[model samples]
Target: MDDKTRVPSEITPDQWTWNVKVDPPFHKKHFNANLVKYHDRVMGQDKLRVFVPLCGKTLDMIYLSERGHGVVGLEFSQIAIEDFFAENDLTYDSEKLDGKPFVRYAARENNITIYQGDLFDLSSEVCGDFDASWDRGSFVAINVSTRAKYGRLMSNLIKPSGKILMELYQYDLAKCTGPPHYAEEKDLVENFTEFQVRMLSEFVVVDSPPYYSGDDFQLGVALLSH
Candidate 1:
């Protein structure tokens, strides 16, 4: 996760990074070109519902919704979710869930609803099943031990025919502090057995704000399908 910066041991990196830092590796000022192109290729112009987990106000939601897709995202941090609406200069209407204290933020201009709550607590009853899901930093951000649980949640959220485009990084663990953890093909297959993991492409980040002593790392983009 871009939020996984090396900081003092006392503070939680994920929440603290969002509170003060805006330059995380995956937080881009503009819509990600890779996402736009990928969506065009597989999803086309259909007004499909797209799920984004651990979504940190990626401008991609605005891009997708403007293209007529319904965008739904889950973010665990209230501050991060609030910052997203504020930073984008987007006016939104928020409503609390039935009995829970959590709120869901909806954009005024597009079909985008972002739920500020835990990923595990989110139900299909709220966001519903998606036609596809975008997992930029989500998989890698989760704890290694919980990959199976994450996989199960996704399997239930995505329709049988739905696809997922996710990002994974491969780095020497000895040299890096991971939350944007290093993952291998076997790990994905072993944990997410319900889906077929097909490696789409790979690229190297030329410049990154390294949290560790390593210079650069490779990012693998994979398509998960049933």
Candidate 2:
């Protein structure tokens, strides 16, 4: 949807928390290929600190951790965090952040930590900073009106020289409304004005899975840096 026609009601943390419990189709049990393909290109460091936004029970966090990168995920759902640990057979210790609206869960043996709370409530003080960030599908999943805010939050969470690896879905706005919104090139540039944006790859698909369907849907992979 375009700026003028975009709806203003952003989905709340409670809504997302509830959605994950129902086994939403968007929840993937495997690592996203796009992430693995672009990992080295987008994230140059082997042992880096990485931030993941709107991270569900994604196996990507484990994938990154296994490769020696420290991963910190910001998610809104306690259910999702619990599932991630249970499915992976990882034991974790939980505690609430002193002044923040989040509970932190850190794996005992891995360099993976997850903060469960509203993304809007996260700050640099609470999350610290990272060398890189990954947005597997979060940019498109959030409301359009909050995109700028989200971008700023990401910018703040990373170091000045940090990089961002993002995956986006693009489609004809007239055909559908989206949780997976149509994030065009211009939208990416505008939202991440502080960074140098590059379109790594893009392709059109006709027969997407039921979770993402469109006649001429586009999938885009991009890398951004300050």
Candidate 3:
């Protein structure tokens, strides 16, 4: 489908709950290399607080915590958050957020917390501003219609000097439908007008998922700063 005629995903929170049960390939058991490589540059310190949007059961959270960073994750599925703690063998305490359809889980011994709810509902009031942010697949995974809102929320969540390390994908949208949508450099710049956007790396990915299997999927990592 052409970009103009493309249908946006109508995926609900329930659908994401089911997706986690089946174990998707995008779910990795280890740290994402891009996140590890850029952590120091983007976050700068070991004691910083990092915000992660649409954070599934990514091991990147654990990786960040191991390095002494306080990690806050926003997710929609309770299953995903539960699985994260279970898989990582961490014990946690849960509490409901007042006046919100969400729960917060805090790991007993780690500086890691995950809030379960629609990411759009997040605000600085809900969670204080962060020092840094990470977007591994979130920009591409969310429906295109919400991309601007996503960017705006991220901007609000971070401090003025905070950096965002984002991983995105680019491909011919006409050839595939996606939870992983095509995100161009222009899209990033347009949504994050307050920040200086820089494409840190780009490469053709050979082993993409079924939706983009035959296409030349260009994976990119961008660093955004104020």
| lDDT tens readout by residue for model 2, 1-226 | 3343644346655676444337666778889888899888777557999999999889999989987999999898788889889889999999998877899999998999999998888888998999998898688888888889988988889899999988877665655567677787788799988988988886556355475445677788888897
Per-residue CA lDDT of model 1 for 1-226, tens digit only, reads 3432443122232453665455566687898766876887767778889998988878888787888889998887777777778877788999998887458999886688899877877777777899998888888887776789989998889999898888788765566666777776777898888999988876566454457566557777788895
Q: Each prediction's Cα lDDT score?
A: 0.77, 0.82, 0.83
> After superposing candidate 1, which stretches have Cα over 4 Å from the reference?
1-16, 20-25, 203-205
Q: TM-scores, in order shown?
A: 0.87, 0.91, 0.92
Whole-model lDDT, model 1: 0.77
Candidate 2: pairs in clash: none
lDDT of 3 by residue, 1-226 (tens): 1464767465655566445448766788779988989887777665889888889889999989988999999998777899999999999999998897779999998999999998888898888999888899788787787878878887888899888899887666666777777777888999887888999886557467765656576788999896
Query: What order do you get sorting by TM-score, best first?
Result: 3, 2, 1
